[model samples]
Target: MKMHLWSEFIAVIKKEVVPALGCTEPISVALAAAIAAQKLSGKVQKIAVCVSPNLMKNGMGVGVPGTGMVGLPIAAAVGAIAGDPTAGLEVLKRITPKDVIQAKALLNCDSVSVNVADVSYTLYAKVTVSSGIDFITVTIADSHTQVLSIEENGVSTYIAPQFCSKKPQSYDPFKDIVVKDLYDFAVNIPISYISFIEQAQTLNEALSIEGLTENYGLQVGMTFQRNIERGLLSHGLLTDVIMHTSAAADARMDGAMKTAMSNSGSGNQGITATVPVVVAAAYLGVGKDKTLRALVFSHLVAIYIKSQQHKLSALCGASTAAMGAAAAITFLLGGNYQQISHSLSSMIADIAGIICDGAKPSCALKVSSAAGAAVKAALLALDGMHASGDDGIVTNDVDQSIQNLCALVNGSMMQTDVQILDIMINK
Candidate 1:
């Protein structure tokens, strides 16, 4: 029996699965700046960016698109100079070299300052753009692009609600949902209703192709490709999935001038969840109908796991997202729901405690690593192997196991975020 409305399911996925340029943290900073710029009457002369520790941690070392710079300041400046506010996460998509030059000039003048916010929200970015006499502040919280409020000169201004409906609607899609619900939806939902998911392939695969072909940071994907050519690495679904998934991360983390279809506000998470299934289905010669169903299952499963955890934590989202791929790969491998449950449990057992130091070129390595484990875990699940109930965080119930993992991340690992950020800042 379907326990949730298909409308509810579509709304959740559409809201979360969207396109983002560059790393989401920096791009979010840019979006906030662009919003401020859009509301300003004069040229932007100063910018003040206050973000939560998690935001700073992720945005600090990652590349900003088209600038060859790595940090929030350049992203903010470029966003102010050239970003389009209505474009949401793609605010920096249209940035040009001329815009980069102007942003650098603004930075040289010491016109931009980024500080850690005093707030407690895990995903928060507040950008204040000024034209000397007047300024606008745009704040996004909880979600990457969700604008909590817009203010001009310390007074709240009216901005159309981006995600709100004319009628108040509760959007707790995961409140009572489980993996079984995801399976049912993926299997029973009409293909036309979920075909929009194919765009994840269209957007993410381009990033992989660019990352493999170009000398993006670390070249993790290209490295796998090279090894395969020389017989150093066996070329197959698993290796190819890892290569394709990591390549997208390499391009995204290196600020390759392309957009990624982000999942749960992280582009690498989207790539990890999408490319593995896409590459696997292609390698296995799966049909479009089955592949699309698997894609929906993969992405929704990723979203479901993420919903159980903090928006950002010491927990590497790549692992959680890869669990989704694990479930999908099991489905593609002709495993039943019980095998899928084993795959999820196996993934939790395999990567229950991966840390997210921050977003960087090495993130591709993590995505690559997790994608491989997901594939391996799925195969093992097919063979009736999984984490024992007595295992650290695994349990007889998959849902309970996921919550245990979240408990660890949202509980003790928060301090890990602080320690990691401390080391990063001090170093």
Candidate 2:
């Protein structure tokens, strides 16, 4: 890779991978509400929030950190009362017990309302907060925390035209990123430049440990550990990988107050991409440099694949992130580029169409399942076996195979997203 392209890749990683305090959908909503509240005077008497359908679908069931509450109403109320907009996705990190009480009170007073917006963008949120007759409106679009506009008292205070409009043309920041390029960069990049990726391991591992040690979500990771201890499940690399990764998801989805190093605006995706690779590298006793390289490779692969799909989609993100883990595990196991590619193809072939109902405790089940599939896929790839091009959505070219999977999620699954949302709202 050229120096310029390498620099761009580093920049992309820094921009896309960062710490987030909760599921991003609700955090983004909270961020918008926080921004709107910042523009208001006196106590916020009412908060009305409208989000894109995808946001509504995702935020509807996920827990908000520190509140032990699920869905957007509480998230928006808490944002108005205590969120720090400048924190971006970590906007709710500062939320306190007092703030939780106030937020709940606001909800009980029926001062907070959430509705689906009539918007074209897959990622959009509009938050309006009122105090007496005065009101402020803040909108976020295109990307989480990318505030599009802010209006105060019927007067526009700030607006970015490029992001404010709904007909914005598609933008692909990772257009230059390819699977081969990712492999080469991960292997060849200077250790100093990529060492920052280790923070993902530290943060996500902490969440995993919390999940395993405490009862959170469905306790999938804890259950795995218990089963292993009781001799019901084998103790090995595969179980270790699933336990660590699913535990992280368990804590994240069940509202642990800790932050996760998110990838592509998702904590679960970050955990899925990082923990499996970390466990595999440790199990193999790889050196620090090699472990870092494998992690960088895994995370970059996930970011690259997710770039091909919408930020929020009907497809479960764990499936795509798990493919990245499979590639990393293959690399750690001494598999070459061809084997890594086969691992990715095998993963995509296995879990191409898993529906994303919502972000909730049950997400740990999918995360564990995807991690297990990734390990299976990697082992198969090492043995020179994988899904053939004739398999559904699997192409001879790994890149084309990824594109085919993305096409299914982004284009063909439109109705699936709508129907899922309908069922969720009605339920």
Q: Could you give the C-alpha RMSD of every candidate to the true structure, in order shown?
A: 2.3, 1.7
Best by TM-score: 2
| Shift in Å, residue 373, candidate 2 | 1.0
Model 1 lDDT tens row, 17-123: 89988999988899999988999999999999999988999999898989998999999999999998889888888888999999999999999999998897888
- Candidate 2 lDDT over residue span 27-88, tens digit each: 99999999989889889999999998889888988889999999999999999999998898
Task: Kindly give the stretch of ten consecutive residues in candidate 2 with the minimal lDDT sum.
Answer: 167-176
Please list the residue runs of candidate 2 whose C-alpha ends up more than 4 Å from where it truly belongs after superposition.
1-3, 164-173
